[model samples]
Target: MNKKSLSQQIYEARWCYLFVLPCSILTGMFVLYPIGMSWYFSLLDWSGFTKDAKFIGLQNYAEAINDPFFWNAFSRSFIFMFGTVPVKIILGFVIAVFLNNQVLKLSPFFRTIIFMPVVTAIAIIGIVMTFIFSPFNGPANKFLMATNLTSGPIDFLGNPDTVLPTVMGVYVWKWLGITMMYWLAALQTVPQDVYDAAKIDGAQGYRLWIHIILPIVLPFAIVIILVEAVSALNVFPLIETMTAGGPFFSSEVMEVYIFRTAFVTDAGTMPRLGYACAAGVFWGVAVLFITALQGFWMRRTRRI
Candidate 1:
């Protein structure tokens, strides 16, 4: 049979194209349009409020490069990603292993309990966590004091030294359930027969896990870690609600930095929309590079 012409193929799949039209339109409007606009705005000198925007070429980007606060925010984002991703992966895998045990009772209930936070609104969790970790009369400090863990209340969200780590901890706790679910799914891919055969051969417990189960689930673990690493960079809402990048901008990630530059202007200074867009474009490229790296690694792992 002859291959169909492009026009003929289009005619045959007209209904499929029709079905995809709405999503394509929405994506163009929301995703593509904004991306294009961001790049265009990055080359301009616009305050976002004024109708007139002067084209300044790459000055905004150059300014961003020299800006110390921009570098600080960028470093903080990576720190958060590095801090949370490993803890989430290891802890999530451990919890998933425990829950995946066939002899364990009420595993489903425990899974639901753990996963509840994943579905909870970040804003709500942030608010509740802020209150819980409040420096004065907060439940956490109260407990610590009660147990004599510390003689004085610790400002978990207030101190610059502690804020980022405290935020990282909350982020891991909030998203741990999803990572656990990923591990649980990976665990399910191991056949019962494989486990039984391993048992028959006297391979059990840590030996069975390290030798057999780990090899089987290694790919999934890698993918999960990469995905979570990307996710760990996006904690704007939680940080905003809990600390608002407070105590002298200690917790300002890229997202918060962009928002502050684009919208939050101090007295006598206009909102630097163009500069913010430049920063955003830079950060977006970095994230895109990371995502591409993830794809490359995943492909290599699949080949192996």
Candidate 2:
């Protein structure tokens, strides 16, 4: 290419990079920077309490595999992911469908009310949920008592049997709006002619959902499912705010456990920074794998 043409191209490229420089720098400092440091730290044995860091290779990973607490937390992540994603997707779709009906009035008001929690403080919701789950003097138990549904108080958050479910419920409440909004956007894009054709073909209700609406919204549904899967696997704030994975670690997800390992422990002037780094690395890799699989499935579905 001529020098003038090449110079013009270089100038354009330089300006493009300059425009994106701020975003790239922020991402590097906040995201890529930590990831790089974590990878380095994962190869060392550092009691986060001091500067006495010793390089220990893959020992932390070895210990992580054998650590019962680590495995328990890891397993809990999957269970919570499985419980939350399907419920969120299905309920969000149903709610979107219900609200989409022409007969529904004041739809914007209802949508705003539903989405309020999405903007609420995580700590506030956690505290409110904790109160609601309180066995004594909680509003929920008061309702149950007044209705005679149960004479006894239900310690929803305290009981190991119910902690996971309680957290799951909190997750649904927090995320349902976002998912519903997504579904609503997708539904609005559905061609009206398709529904008209379906009606003429004697397709209605469940048949229409199964044969028409679903097929058209399949791409939207796939995106939500994959997004939910990855997010649920990394669930933290609600758990952090509500249970703190407490009541005997019954509700502990991988995230809270990792943070606890990093900052909450002291082994006679020793901290476990390296182990925490390893755990962080493990979680990141797990998320990446799940995302890759999701992309593959989405591609296959679109092809079909």
Candidate 3:
């Protein structure tokens, strides 16, 4: 016989609010606070740790627009995306097909072996890769020398011409298992009757995959592309530990660039927290833009 006010309704649901309050508070503290602080910092000239955050208005953004190195790093992020994403998607899909094969016994064991690298530490992977690609006595070099491919070690990761591609190869190798799992999960969702019908229609092997399976898994492929695209832009630790963005910054990506600008400047130079925050903000906006484009394209494709 009575209507409750919004406050009264909330009061009645206090326990539900209490249940979600911790998560909300944590999100505000970690996510929202950092974003707000970063945006504020982007407008100031401060060393990240110091209290002297002098407001500089939009000077940081202005500097970023003219900064050649920043633009180079931005371009390199896209290069890294292009170098890794397609290869990983194609190779992962192929591996998923092999693993999903009905005749393949011990598929689980192979899958476990392949996926081990996904759980491995990037630092460890980089270190191991460094040793493996070492010119002196690395296994790869040894194999090459033994096979008479060259007179000596090729310096795969040490050469500027090769380092980015080498890093891409290692990145693809480490993450392929996870991508394979995504594809495999998508593949498993396809109906058995669909395969039966395809087989009855004389579609076999590659034809069945191309005609039927691919259409079914296109959505999963889009998800994988979006995920890997964002991730590939943020590549740092692998490039850090493996190459240190060196061979003269040939492998420097957005994250590595942000870190170097923020904290790892020349010996006498103070950290440019504001400038780095601007760079970070720019990267965040760029990623959001790219992801938005991906979402739009996916929606458009579905409409078609």
Candidate 4:
């Protein structure tokens, strides 16, 4: 209300601005600008790389809805998300319990081993997995062949049935470590006496975990689930690099589909920025929907 009060408030807030300025600028430049640009471009029939254009109102969005490829890619993404998130959460928790125990020596080393892939270049791993999953002469198939386990070679990325699952495998492999590390941090706070008391009550294994530990870790687990769901939805580079959603476009995610539509294909066929934005808007809505449902689930489960 007073000048001095206002001045003091402004003075205090000055450092807040100083601290936040860089992040704000970066968000504006990269995030806000691109979103606005994408929305603007989405309204046009602009070839992503060229100057030729037309203003198509709702046409692209209309086409995107009826497009079979859009729905197919979305379905594959859902499959990938369903496959990876549960396995990652369960395995990560189990691994975190082991890593957090005081009895373990070289805990940091083990932690690093689990988390190494998270830091490793995704592009490089894509190339490596491509070779490993190669039907012929790849080590994976070769090992299976060596063991007399059925056929000579099984197509991992090439086969329609297997491609989505293979990508899901890669998704879990890469993401599990990060989730495990989060669990390990949460594990440290779980009082040791709780486990001892559970043992005294004759509880062990799954019973102890279900009744005691998992509940304590519920918040972290929920956070990880929400983040993973959002990240998994946006997965594109690996989809592009690895499968290209090939074998009749079985694994093409929405992001990859949009990228190809906007930039790769010529305007003569499918350079539909508006369609891509519509796809993005639809995906964004789906993400929000899932997140909302997850939040509701967390609240419901938390009460129990």
Candidate 5:
């Protein structure tokens, strides 16, 4: 058997390359171009309104590093990620396990019910949630009052103290089903014979899960957690529609901060497109670092 030359291999795979050309072009135009432009813009001092963009290297980044509001938004993003990722992982795992049980009737229906929110528009959900948690004439407040849980109507989306947590809850509820699906896929990888063998060895209930099931699913859990953590940083739509980072900017995350800086010009303020791009670049780097860390951990786990 003769080994094919590079030219021959290229010729043979020409059709495959032809098929991928359109998608590659689209990605280059839409994704790569924007990302490259963002980095370039980050190095400038521009208001996005005029062509007078002065090239200022690292000044925007230095400003961002010292900006209190930027740090506040950054910290809030981490808080949201920390608060929601664990709950989503744990609850999603449990629900997936419950749904995976052979004795569970109408599991498909239950799954559909749980996953319905995932497909629903986030904007729509945000609007509905605001109404539901409205201080006056809302069902949530009405129920709370009826049950005497609170003395007055609670402003869920209005109060800074409760707004972050409220949005986190809604975020968890909206995306929990996706986490469940990940767990379900992981669970399917465990062979039934292994379960039967473990059962025969008296490893039942929690013991079986602790020793056998967990070990099998640990790898999957790592990936799922990383995905959820990254996803938690992308709560712009939900937060935008629900809170608009209001109530004293309690719910303002990095994306909202960037948007406000780049586009939303107040009475006397100019839209700092360059500064916003710097913030965005910083955020992108942070996400890359996190992903790299997770990848390192994954490799280490595999070695162990």
Candidate 6:
């Protein structure tokens, strides 16, 4: 038989290419276009609304590098990432284990209940949480007062010392359900026969999880870690709804700073669209670097 020519091969796969064309076009339009625009805007000096965008080369980037507030917000982003990731992952894993148990009944109901928060509107959660943690007439404060743990409302979202951690706690709670679903799906992929063999070899209780379940679940855990890292680092809505970066910019993260610089400002000043874009570009590069590092680490783990 004669080998097919390149043209012949292309003709045979034309339908497959056609099927992918729409998705490719949409991705280019929405995702790729914005990224390119952001890079171009980063080199300019203009408010987003203005038609006259002055090209400023690397000045915006230089200013961002020296901006103390940018670094401060970046540090808070790291704190939010670290604080939320481990707690959610561990709690999610534990819940997944419990739900996976044969002895557990009505697990589907429980799963739906737990996962409701994951599907619920984040804006609603942030608003409700703000009220729950409100200094005046909030249930949380009332409970603390009733329990004699405090003299009055603690102002969880007010004080700089407590605001960041409180937000972290809320983030973990909101995301735990989705994290558990990841673990649960990973756990389901493990063969029951493997567990049976481990049991027959005298593996039970913590040993079963340590040796068998954990190894199988590790890849999924890596995915969860990366997802949570990105999500936590880019946190915006909750901070906006609950604290708006604070009483003193205590709970501010990179995203909050970007929004403020881009849109929010004093009465007479123009929004710093270019500066905000510069900050965004810098942090976007940093996030990409961190994610690439994480992927390399996961790949190495798979080899080991």
Best by TM-score: 1
Residue 50 alpha-carbon offset, candidate 3, angstroms: 2.6
lDDT of 1 by residue, 1-304 (tens): 9999999999999999999999999999999999999999999999999899999999999999999999999999999998899899999999999999878889999999999999999999999999999998999999999999999999999899999999998998899999999999999999999999999999977999899999999999889988898899888999989998888999999999999999987899999999999999999999999889988999999889
- Residues 102-176 of candidate 4 have per-residue lDDT tens digits of 688987898898898898777777788899899978988999898989476999999988888888888788778
Q: Distance from true position, residue 155, model 4, in Å?
A: 1.8
Could you give me the TM-score of model 6 versus the true structure?
Answer: 0.95
Q: Runs in model 3 with CA error above 4 Å?
A: 1-5
lDDT (C-alpha) at residue 105 in model 4:
90
Clashing pairs in 5: none
Query: If candidate 4 were superposed on the true structure by all CA atoms, what would the RMSD be?
Result: 2.8
Model 2 pairs whose backbones collide: none
Listed in order, each prediction's TM-score against the native is 0.98, 0.94, 0.94, 0.88, 0.95, 0.95
TM-score of 4: 0.88
lDDT of 2: 0.88
Give candidate 1 regions above 4 Å deviation: none
Worst 10 residues of 5 by lDDT: 100-109
Q: Which ten residues in a row are the worst by lDDT in model 1?
A: 221-230
> How do the residues 1-304 of candidate 2 rate in per-residue lDDT, one tens digit apiece?
5466877788879978898999999999999999999999998898776888899899999999999888889989999999988999989888888888778887778889899998998778998998987898899899999999999998999998999998998888988899999999999989999999999999987999899988889898898898888878867878988998888889989998888888776456555888999998988898899899889999998888
Error of 2 at 86 (Å): 0.9
Alpha-carbon lDDT of model 1: 0.94
lDDT of all predictions, in order shown? 0.94, 0.88, 0.90, 0.81, 0.94, 0.90
How do the residues 236-283 of candidate 5 rate in per-residue lDDT, one tens digit apiece? Answer: 999988988988998899999999899987799899999999999999
Total clashing residue pairs per candidate?
0, 0, 0, 0, 0, 0
Runs in model 6 deviating more than 4 A are none
Candidate closer to the true structure by TM-score (higher is better), 3 or 4:
3
